[model samples]
Every structure is written in structure tokens, then in C-alpha cells.
Target: MDVARDRGAVAIDRDECKGCGLCVEACPPRVLRLSAELNRYGYHPAEYLGSGCTACGICYYVCPEPGGITVLRRQVA
Candidate 1:
């Protein structure tokens, strides 16, 4: 695998996602997952909890809902 950029702490807004699971499925690295844990929306939004995502923007692009996810920058592999 290529060097995974430590793009700080990425996050997903559970309140925005409809639990469609598109982002999870769309992840090329399969780093996302649909959690049974529901949020304020009462829907299980996708979650990213691993490391070294490569910062490929796959999840960001896949998220149809705007402002659903936030990508940050980090200095670690």
C-alpha cells in the first residue's frame, strides 16, 4: 500500500447521514462501516475509526450529504 497520509482527525456527522450506507460502500479502502449505533437522526451513519486513510477523499466525495464529514490534517503515519 502507498504511504497513508496522516490526515489528522477525520469525522462524520451522524446527524446528517441517513444511514444509507453509501459512504461505507463507496470507501475504496473499506475504512468505513455502518454502525448499528444510531445518532440524533436515529439512523446509523457511517464511521471511520482506523488509521492511515491515504487521504484519498473517497469518503468525502462519496458522502452525498454536504458537511456530513470533516477531514483534518495530522503528522503521523
Candidate 2:
């Protein structure tokens, strides 16, 4: 695969998220969005939509809850 074309993966801990939508708005790729389903916390969690994730970690940085979102960047070696 072309290193430049590599896409990253995003993992969100729905149970911890408060659905603040900070990460969703901060996402440059527009890959993140509020889910239709409610989490155990009764808040609609952020879900990853089909898009090119650059693994910029903007979502992780903007998240209020610690470790609520995890981003795995595709490293080119």
C-alpha cells in the first residue's frame, strides 16, 4: 500500500464519552460523528464514519474524558 494513502483507525470508549461533540467538530477529515445509538451513559457516542483518517489525533486531544478516544496511526516504514 502507498504510505501516503494509509488511513488510521479511531477507537472511542462510548461508555466514557459525554457526547460533547468536541472531537466531532475538531475532526478535519469529518470521519467522526454522533451515533444514533445511546451508550450506557445515555449519551449518543461518537462513531467513526467512512472517511480518510489522517491519524492527526485531533479527536483525542479535544476529548474531555481521559482515554475516551484512541487513535492508531498507520506508520509507513
Candidate 3:
């Protein structure tokens, strides 16, 4: 199996997410997806694909909920 190198990371606050797919659509690397499992509010929240994020912040900017998505850029040595 092939895997992408970890370029960045994304944290999605499921509680804050309202199932809006803006982040999923805006993600450049197409790493974001809406989970089938429902959250506490019974909404499908966005989840990271575990890799391929570019730390572009498009997901963070597109997310309607404040603090819903947090992008962390991998530090280069």
C-alpha cells in the first residue's frame, strides 16, 4: 500500500462542526471527508484522511464554525 508523507495535520472539532462540507470541498489535497458516523448532535462531521494535507489553511478558512478546523504545518528541520 502507498502512503503520503505527512506534510501537515488537521484537527476537526466535531462538536463545533455542523456537517457543513465547505472544508471538505475547499481542501486542496482532497484529504478531508465527511464521516458516516454521526456526532453528538447527530451530524456527519468532517474527518481527516490521516495524510496528504498541505497546511494550506483553505479548510480552516472555509469552515463556517469558528475553531472548527485547526491546521498544523509540519516543522522542517
Q: What tens-digit string does per-residue lDDT give for candidate 2 at 5-63?
A: 74787889889988999999999978899999999989999987755788999999999
Cα deviation in Å at residue 77, candidate 1? 12
Q: Which residue runs of candidate 2 sit more than 4 Å off their true CA positions? A: 1-5
lDDT for predicted candidate 2 compared with the true structure: 0.87
lDDT of each: 0.74, 0.87, 0.89
Model 3 alpha-carbon drift over 4 Å, by segment: 1-4
Please give the lDDT score for candidate 3. 0.89
Question: How would you order the candidates by lDDT, starting with the best?
Answer: 3, 2, 1
Total backbone clashes of model 1?
A: 2
Clashes of each: 2, 0, 0
Model 2 lDDT, residue 40, Cα:
93
Candidate 1 off by > 4 Å: 1-9, 75-77
TM-scores of all candidate predictions against the true structure: 0.74, 0.86, 0.91
Q: Which ten residues in a row have the lowest lDDT in candidate 3?
A: 1-10
lDDT of 3 at 23: 91
List, residue by residue over 1-77, the lDDT tens digit for candidate 3. 12345778899999889998999998888999999999999999999998888888899988989899999997887
